[model samples]
Target: MKLVSYKLKQKPSTLRVGFVMDDKIIDVQEAFLQLPGHSTEMEYMLPSEPNAFYKIGIPAIEKAKKAYTYVMENQVEEISFHRDEVYVATPIPEPSKIICVGKNYAEHAAEMKSEVPDYPVLFAKFANALVGPEDQIVKNSKTNKLDYEVELTVIIGKEASNVTQEDALNYVAGYTIGNDGSARDLQKRTPQWLQGKSLDNSTPVGPWIVTADEVGDPSNLDIHSRVNGELRQSSNTSKLIFDIPYLISFISSLMTLKPGDMILTGTPDGVGFALNPPQFLKGGDKVQLEIEKIGRMENEVIEGEFHY
Candidate 1:
């Protein structure tokens, strides 16, 4: 099911959780309200935490499904929503930390004249950088060489520590598209890429999160990025030097990964930095990132005068 967080016209201040059915959202709460005694379970699952669903939402959904099924059987209400009316938020907004992988793709490593690391190259972005799919990515004056890195980001489903590669995926809640927008000049100025990467509104994520069951074999998906209408990067996740399972296990070994924490699996070759003249993003450029099965994110670049 394509689970999403959105604000309805009736409740603009609060986010509502629901499954995307056709065009209309299958209001999970409304569905439960129609149920006999599952209202408490719905309340328990209403916390903004995405992992709560696994602990409470799923079971509640299962029970509610029975009633919904009956409703469907009886033709109580059709499952359709008008796509244009709802304001969509990140499937999990305000995640604690956005962990990102650097140069996990072999060709990407080669393009930057770096060796494919035997271990995963981990970095992080602050939560303030997180924005939903349609949000604008600000290009500040400090960054003349703005670039886009299309990546497959994994959303953690539960708190994890010392997980094994074999059991790593079990900790994953789902997957989403992550555009690791970077200021190449700033990134290279310091050994740490944090400054260039963690700029506000840098990480444009979502369209929506697809559950792990729906995105089986995460490494097999096609990941690509385009500027305006031109394709700049196209590669499969299979080219990843460090796959999802390894990343989860590796990161978990070092620190605990809580639910809503995300991991960007790195980008493919063909970043603007690899070009002879380095194609950087300017104000008004549209960046489109598409990951097979996950979804697509289209962001417009706007100039921000302040530079740090």
Candidate 2:
């Protein structure tokens, strides 16, 4: 099942959760109310927040699946909400942690001229960096160089610590696409990339989350990016130096991976910085990141610095 955090266009400022079946978006809350067994307790049980929704685990998935199936088979008219009628938010809008891997792709490692490490290189982005797919990526006036890294993001389904690589897949809630936007100048300024990598509104995640079962093999999928309609990065997850299972095991060993937490598997090569003479983003540049079987996330760069 594909799950999404969204709100109706009429209530763009509010957040709701849903999933897509085609061009239509089935609002989970609304669908649940229409389901046969729904009650006051069931209403209370339904997760309205994206992060809280995943806490219930597979049962929530099962509920959505049953509701969606019922809606399709019996309550077709009730789906008055269309995909165009709602705004999609970052799938895990307030995930407790947004951990990311760097240079996990071999070609990416070679492009950056960095050694392929035996271990996964991890970094983080807080809630400030997270934005919905449709949100504008702000270009700060502090520096000129901005870049995009397309990555396959994993969302943890349960609490885990020191999980074995062989059983790592069991802990995954699902998958989504992530655009690891960076401030190139700030990143190169220091050894620790936090400043450049975690700028406000820098990360664009979603369209929606595709449940792990549907994605099957996360390590082998087509991933690509297009900046302003021009193809920039095109590679497969098969090129990943440290695949999902290993990364999950490694990361969980260091800290507990909680439900709704995210792990960005890392970007493939072809980042703007590695190009001949380099290419950086400017205001109005549109970026599109696509991962096979998941979906495409498109966002545009907006001019000027962000202010509180």
Candidate 3:
């Protein structure tokens, strides 16, 4: 099931499961309102917590499905919503911390002239960096070299600590596309990449979260980035030196991972920095990050004045 957080006309945003029926998004909440005993279930399921969807939302959806199935059999009022009319928010909009893996791909490591760590090289982006699909990524003049890194993001489902590689997948709730937008100049000035990576609204995260069951074998998908309709980074998760399970276990050993915490599995080669005359993102540029099965995320780059 493809789950999304969205806002409908004049309504506050809420978590919803999306289904493509007749090429329109089936508004699960709207359909649920028309069902008997759904109100109670919705109240119990719908919460601000990221893990609530798995704990309560899925079960509620299952119950609603039976009602929806019956309604379909009887041909009740058609439930459909136009895609453009709805506003999509991040699947887990307010993650506690966005943990990212650096140099997980050998080619990416080589391009940056860094040694591939035997263990995962972890960094973090605060919640302020998070943005959803269709959101604008501001390009401030303070940083001249803006780059994009397309990565597979893992959303944690349960609280985990000291997890083994074998049991790591169990804690993952779903997967989403992450663009680790970087300020190349600032990133290179310091050994730590935090300042360059954690800029406000730098992380363009989600269109939807494809459940782990739906996106089996996370390392086998294609991940790529396109700037202004031109493909720049094209590679597969198979090229990742450290796969998802190892990443989760490695990080979990250092710190506990709670629901809503995201782990960016790292980007592939072909970043603008690797180019001879390095093509960096400028104002008015559009970036598209696509991960197979998880869908694509597009964002516009707007020029902004530097502050501080």
Q: Candidate 2 on 273-296: residue-level lDDT in tens?
A: 999989999988999999999989
Please tell me which predicted candidate would have the highest TM-score against the true structure: 2
Looking at model 3, the pairs that clash are: none
Error of 2 at 204 (Å): 0.5
Candidate 2 CA-lDDT value: 0.86
TM-score attained by model 2: 0.95
Stretches > 4 Å off in candidate 2? 11-13, 42-44
lDDT of model 3 at position 13: 61
Positional deviation of 224 in candidate 1, in angstroms?
Answer: 1.1
Model 1, which residues run further than 4 Å from truth? 9-11, 41-45, 48-81, 305-308
TM-score of 1: 0.88
Query: Which lDDT value does model 2 have at 225?
Result: 97
Candidate 1 local lDDT, 1-308, one digit each (tens): 56677776655456666666566666555554555554565444344333344334234335445545655556446443566767776666667768999989889999999988988888889777777765788887778888899999898877889999999988887788888989899899989999999887767888887778778889799988999999999999898888899999999999998777889999999999998878999989999999998778898888984322
Tens-digit per-residue lDDT, 75-112, candidate 3: 54566667776777667666776899999999999998
RMSD of 1: 3.2
For every candidate, C-alpha RMSD to the true structure in Å: 3.2, 1.7, 3.4
